[model samples]
Target: MNAVVFGAVLCAGVAAWVLCARDEAVRRARTLLVGPWGPPGPGCGVPGLRRLDVRVQALLEPFRVRFGWRLGRELLCLPAGLVLSVAAHSAVPAVLAAGAVPLVGRWLRGRESRALAEERALAAGALCSAVAGDLRAGLAPQGALAGALLREGWPGRPALADAALPLLAAARFGGDVPAALRTAARLDGAQGLAGVAACWQVAVDGGAGLADGLDRIAAALRSERDQREDLRTQLAAPRSTVLMLALLPLFGLVLGAGLGADPVGTLLRTPFGLGCLAAGGLLEWAGLAWTARIVRTAEAS
Candidate 1:
């Protein structure tokens, strides 16, 4: 009698689930057959789903601009969540790993920002050389700048052009060139423009030689770029060492498996093994963070 009652309850639950699923499918089909189709209406059934969707979109805006729409938050978190879930056979660690996706995105953005800075620095040097050459060839300041902008294969051209547009307009209208340049210097990824602005200001205000000033600035920028390259070469060994050390745990895991131990299963299934895994992950993260911080500080200097 007890077995019959249990079977009946199971069958009832399954039937209810099937009915709900069928109703949902029919509702979706009706929506599709009707006009103005997209996701179901905002008012349709699921509690908090709309709010959660809005929140996620809001969070993804910056990342979408940096890393594409498809490759933003979902790409970063989903694989990480899956890997953690598979490794641990648990949801809690997977959620925690997924939560770290933003940090990974932030780090990638930082690297991109630094690379952009370096590119802008190189482009500023090239611009200074080109403008100085044009000025020395008897062109006016406006013509020199315009000619430089026309040059092909100029690094950071898009960003520089965007920043220089206001300056170009001001120059054509006999307006304040220094003020426009200062504004350009305030733009994102245009920090190198500050040096150009300072050179322009001094030449205009003190009746100094703008061409000579630009030439000196170009030389100094090239020197700084060389120094930065040297610094990167010096830091390469240490960075490699840190990366190798981070991989040591993976090596150990592989070695343990080769020795006939069920290392992965032990780590995933046992509380003590989970504790060690978490601790090691934290240490590795800390080490990587410290290395990155040091490298960034050196680059800034």
Candidate 2:
């Protein structure tokens, strides 16, 4: 009776570690990647990647909803691949494929983000050129702003179409240019833009030198852009190291499996192996969560 009771307790513990406990760990790790709790369901939106997000989110729904958290698209695929691997009675391909999804997503997102960023940069550059030309022609800040709005054909014209143009019109009809730029800043989502608009607003409102203020604001933007670039360069190496570190143990397991080692069979069949697999999966998720937190901190800074 004693031995039977011990064996039952051990089996319960193993089951908890593999299915129930690991799912919880995966969910917690996901919450770290996305903002708190996510969209409250399986299908969530990832801006600019809706279709892919929905598919991945659907696949991840079971793990997430059951565990009360969200998971990264990449991590969501991992368990599915793992389950498939076990179902197909193969472990090596499962782990490798699971790990590759996130890396591929990251690469694709990075490329797209870079292209969008370049568009924004070109828009800013055109806006600066207009400001410079207007300044050279002795236009007051209000006059220059109006000219830029009326000029048309500038990159990101819509950025100013609604708020800036209407504000400039009001200024021309005897309203405040500073107020208009401030309104523009408020409407658009970029702080640098708001800051530039505010600088112009202050210049016009306080009767400061319009050209000098524009130059100063542009200088500040240039400094900020430089700092962001430097930070990205600094972060690249450390982020790669973290990813490589995370994959090391999983790859080692895969290597064992490829060598015809029965780690999966043992993991599924034996109480000790199951507990270890469960513990390892939890630890892997915890490590990824920790790494993600570090990245978030860096990004916020």
Candidate 3:
């Protein structure tokens, strides 16, 4: 088919994919995370096709995980390719570009997720350390917690700060130290902190010591922090390789389509060529799927 007709078909297919995804979301009572080439919303799309998306997502997840890339870019690229195909009037280049978009998107998403996760983990660790030290130095748990949170400039600090006001009220008006402690714990991003606060709250009600509990929490947080860093280090090399492998074929295919022999176009032009093209696409997808599986297994190991 000519580029215009091919692009229209491709666009129609994408539209169908999107519509199906939307229907599936509706049937399942789940929010649609995104609309075709649009922003995400919860429970906005197709339910039946979400399973298909999960399969696609699974294949893409490893690449996104390893490369620190955004899934959105890969997603956007498909529509971009369709639009580009229409504009380029060249089926080969458009098809090749369309195929490459997801890899790029996942890589971007992975990077963003990694950075955010690290920051939160580090903040949790630091908050743990600061609270332990401050409490030991005779500061009330609230004081220590507030100071730690302030120092970190946490992304969600405003919400935590707002939560703290009612907690402070609970301590002052109700004379309920336990309730206050629980509130403080909830405000902090540290899940372990909640446990510690609960313990202290109980201790306050019953007149017990919390020094030991605080020490244990600090130690645990520190250990967890170290483990996360070590895991990141271990995965670094393999992640790099996964990204390269996932991207290389896409780049090569596109380069071949655009610069080398126009096999994609030939495939479109002839029945035999079409069979070969379909086979090649299938093989390419299989290889990508295999590489993604390997990456995930390696990451898990």
Extract clashing residue pairs from model 2.
Answer: 30-71
Best by TM-score: 1
lDDT of 2 by residue, 1-301 (tens): 2332343344334333222111223233445543353222221233334444445566767886789644543354455556545554546436655677766447445543444344344444445557767977988656676676556333123333345445557646867655555565554233445656666666656876666666666676677677777888988998899879976865675677667786556775578876887798789879887987887698669
**Candidate 1 local lDDT, 120-181, one digit each (tens):** 67877887899999999999987787668557333224334445557667756777777776
RMSD of each: 15.0, 12.9, 12.0
lDDT of each residue in 223-247, candidate 3, tens digit only: 8777666877987887688658656
Against the reference, the lDDT scores of all candidates come to 0.63, 0.55, 0.55
Q: In each prediction, how many residue pairs overlap at the backbone (N, C-alpha, C within less than 3 A)?
A: 0, 1, 30
How close to the true structure is residue 11 of candidate 3, measured as C-alpha lDDT? 56
User: Candidate 2: worst 10 consecutive residues by lDDT?
Assistant: 17-26
- Model 2 ranges with Cα > 4 A deviation: 1-129, 138-143, 146-177, 183-189, 268-271, 299-301
Q: Candidate 3: worst 10 consecutive residues by lDDT?
A: 26-35
